[model samples]
Target: MRKTTYLLPALVVAIVVVLSSIFVVDEREKALVLQFGQIKAVKEEPGLAFKIPLIQEVVRYDDRILSLDTQTIEVTPSDDRRLVVDAFARYRIADVVQFRQAVGVGGIRVAEDRLSGILNAQIREVLGADQVTSDRILSKDRGELMIRIRDSARVQARSLGLDVVDVRLKQTNLPQRNLEATFDRMKAEREREAADEIARGNEAAQRVRALADRTVVETLSVADRDANVIRGEADAERNRIFADAYGADPEFFAFYRSLQAYETSLKGDNSTMVMTPDSQFFEYFKNELSTNGSVTLPDPVARAEAPDAPAPDAPEAPEMPEPFNLTPVDPAPVDPAPESPEAVDPTPEAVDPAPAPEAPEADTPPADN
Candidate 1:
């Protein structure tokens, strides 16, 4: 019974050691066997793995893709514009043995820290290159920039047994102090462009207005010149007609002109003229002239040039004559005297003061026909 008890204790201890040496690795994990801080073996596949119990231990790391958000950092681009940038990276541990050797006991946390530093440094180098600018970082080309950063970071991360699958820029913006200044600069640029456009428009408008004004002046001048030419032609034709009529009949023309003057001078409700009673203006008013129809009017031009005759000497001063009235006055008609029985027919032959000496009595008696 004492021998059975010792064997049973030994078997239980052996079972405990075997169970501790055998470990099952999960599909999502990578296992590293370490002997006193030195990497002895790596388990990259999911299944049972063996290790010397009490002398070695297995360290497992996630084999799935992992994500890390880098800290916001400030970088200056080629144009000297500073920017605040935020980024994220997707990665996985590709070499568990290398990872265990590099990170030691710190494991994924330490590896992540180192990867973050690598990503940040690569971002600065690529984004701050001579050809890169702040505009490129915030534009569609940012994808290209991120790819460059990932490639550069992947090279550096390989030393840490990490594979950088992709890197992306999440946020890229101007610093707080620069935001207002940038906006102001943009506003000023736009305003300058607008002012330039307005000036150009005004210049074009002025050009159009000037052209229109010149055209208007030219048109009006041409029209006025034509109008004046036509008016002068009309006046010349009128004078020609007047001259022809005057050449046809001087007496009739004079009478018609006098009638026109009278009509002009004696118009309206009240018309007055002061002149002598025997003035030539009333020459047609004489009964003898009116009955004879043989009116003669003095030529004004001849009268104006002729010297005045000497006044007749008067024994006494003549009395002042009353002013002539222009108003028409009808005279009383005189009745003809009745003919007497012995009245003489006053022919020119009977009116001779002295008888013409009978034309020496004809020698022969006149024959009657």
Candidate 2:
């Protein structure tokens, strides 16, 4: 009985000592001792910690930084633009007592919900308003709007006994439905610009073609005028040369012209020309017809005997040299005895002057009267 009593007392002392001594706490967690629903101690340091065994309860909570990510929500601005917003936050518990009171072990999810609401409210208020729409933030100025939003979210997240260290926004973009409209508008603008360029090119081409036509016309006209002037000058020079030749020898010119005409007109035709026997133009034909024909000039005396008048039956010859005319000599009187210086005998025949024996009367008997 004495052995049992000593053992019970010793065991009771050992239990008391164990309950009053330390409990281990990790760096990642905070330990709280609770007695009768009241906080008796809190251990924020690492290593061993003491607590009452049955009278006090130890509750450890994560003291490390944590993250809360919210679901995307449709945010509408005053301009009626709606977009999905995704946001996240990082926090750690600072006041373990307050954390326990505000957000119990299972109530952290609820607390996160409350924090999300606060973050959303602040984001909306700073970045947007019900009556006004703006991406600009006033507290952090216009350029640093995103920074201010994150900072403001962190500050506002503390109300739920949670500290927010970082807040981030991942993506913000137009929805699929708006993309096609934007592309269509861009295409329309490009088409307009292309059309304008084409129109200008056509205008330039028209101007060039017009200029070419005008140049062609002017060049052709100038060439035609030059040709006409040159032709006229050539014709005038030809006429002058011909006139000078004719003026120099009209008769010769006429002969040449007649020969040219005969060459041109009589060569191919089958007509024969006839003329009188003694025609000047018949000389060639007559000479050709006679076997012994010879071309010779007429005797001068004969030409004088027959002054060749233009015969109506004769074919005319072009102007040719005229034949010379000659006179017929009187028959010389037998030279009557050499005309013996006889002019002295001018008396009728001579026989000394008078008493010429007249042919006696014998011869007288005039024949029967």
Q: Number of the top candidate by TM-score?
A: 1
Candidate 1 local Cα displacement, residue 300, angstroms? 26
Q: Rate the local accuracy (lDDT) of all candidates.
A: 0.77, 0.61
Best by lDDT: 1
TM-score of each: 0.54, 0.46
Report how far off residue 312 is in candidate 1 (Å).
Answer: 36
lDDT of 1 by residue, 275-360 (tens): 76555565334332334676444443442233153322323324545653465432333332222232322221221232234767
> Taking the tens digit of each residue's C-alpha lDDT, what string does model 2 give over 1-369?
999999999999998788566689999999889888788888999998887677888888888888888777666556655555677777787788887787666656777778888777766665566444433322234435556667787676555567778777665444567657757987999999999999999999999999999999999999999999997887677666656745554434333443343343333325344444454332323222223565543332332233343312323435534452223233323322111111222111121222224564554455665
lDDT at residue 70 of model 2 (Cα atoms): 74
The stretch of ten residues in a row with the least summed lDDT in candidate 1 is: 344-353
Query: Cα miss at 18, model 2 (Å)?
Result: 1.8
